[model samples]
Target: MKERWELMDDSKIVQLYWDRNEQALTATSDKYGNYCITIAKNILGNKEDAEECVNDTYMRAWNSLPPHRPNILSTYLGKITRNLSFNLYKRNTADKRGGGEVPVVLDEIVDLVSDTDDVEKEIDRRELVKAIDDFLGKLPADKRSIFICRYWYFDSISNIASRFGMTNNYVSVLLNRLRLKLHNYLLERGFEI
Candidate 1:
């Protein structure tokens, strides 16, 4: 059975925030806490840090709301959670070797992401996002899913293979091909390599 807070729709929850109701936090947590935590844990590979990131996400959401009402609440919260988790992961790994699938995931996409500061800024630019989105849109559904699973969700190769019923090697090879295609796609759109 779902709790009452869990039953409230996202609009109502957003309204609760706008209304200055503290129950807003409870409702948002009940609804998306686990989702955010999974995203955090996937990136950080630590249960405790994941939970902290989710909590910080709520705080950030609360602060950002009442003035900025997101069109898609889940995506908004998710972006916040993902960004916070990555920041935490960077901080935790700065002086030491980073653990878990995140570094592996990053390594796999190394060719796709730019390393130079200017190129990095270019990657974050909205036009680059649209180009990537366009490229993903043109890809076959399975390939797109593979790319999103490995990069966006940071799923391990074996896990992604299990999800898609492919051999792990097949998934790895497919991901490599997809990355090359995306790299070319971005380059063709006038983005810095």
Candidate 2:
């Protein structure tokens, strides 16, 4: 059976927010709580921390909805959860003692994404993001999905492999190749490294 909030479409939920209905929080939570928590946990590796980040995501969404409207509520919420989770992950792993896939996952593409401090330049950052998006858009559906699953969702290699029916080593090799392709793709588009 569908929940009451599940019966309401994302637009209606967004409308509830626009109308300043507090129940909007309930609706959003009912619909996207697990989705947000999964994104958080994929990066956080801690259920309590992931849940905390998801709650923070709700607060962030609540505060942002007054002036900003997201066309895709899930994406908006997922982004918030992912960012908050990553922030927490960084803080928790300052001494680099945590065990999880996030560190290894991030390390795989860190150099490809940013060879130097140019990644920190605000003006270049937006353009680079667009370029990377375009590059991902041009990739085959499976490749793109795998890339997003690993980087955006921070999914484990075994999870991705199982979902795609590929071997563990193949997923790793494919991801490595994709990183190389992304590096070359960005270079061709005039991004320094």
Candidate 3:
């Protein structure tokens, strides 16, 4: 079935959400729920937490739509789910005094950059986003998904391997090669290394 929410205009969707129409909720879920869940599951690494995050995303969307006419509802909902999932993951890690896979993935990138400098200011965010889009678009779909799962989603190597039905060593090699390619691409674009 086609996504009803995507078929409707953003304003109508926003109004439906604001009115708390059950059909609207159903349509929204039908359209974006799986995407949101994937984003949350990739970050949280727990089905229960991901499910909770998806529900929370819908609730947050319902409450916020009246005042926030999001230009891209799917992206907005996905961002909310990802943030909530990450926060919950952080809380769980804090409780156990254990850092999770997501944190480790972020640390790999963090260690490559200077802390005090505003990296965003060095390169236009839009340009960087466009560059990333172009870079991913050039990859085969499977490799692109692998790249996104590893870096964009911050999934652990093992997790990505399992999800993609590959060996951990294979996932690691793929990511390392992709990282090197991306780094070279960025440098060639004159982004500060």
- Report the number of the highest-lDDT candidate: 2
**TM agreement with the true structure for every prediction:** 0.87, 0.89, 0.68
TM-score between model 1 and native: 0.87
Candidate 2 local lDDT, 112-159, one digit each (tens): 655446446777788888998999999999999999999899899999
- Deviation in Å, model 1, residue 50 alpha carbon: 0.5
With candidate 3 superimposed using the best TM-score fit, by how many Å does residue 20's alpha carbon deviate from the native?
3.4
Order of all candidates by TM-score, from best down to worst?
Answer: 2, 1, 3
lDDT of 1: 0.86
Q: What lDDT would each prediction earn against the true structure? A: 0.86, 0.87, 0.76
Better of 2 and 3 by TM-score: 2
Residue 108 C-alpha lDDT in model 2: 89
State which candidate, 1 or 3, has the greater lDDT. Answer: 1
Candidate 1 residues 49-89, lDDT tens each?
Answer: 88999999999989989799998998999899999999999
Candidate order by lDDT, highest to lowest?
2, 1, 3
Residue 177 C-alpha lDDT in model 1: 87
- In model 1, which regions exceed 4 Å deviation? 1-3, 115-124
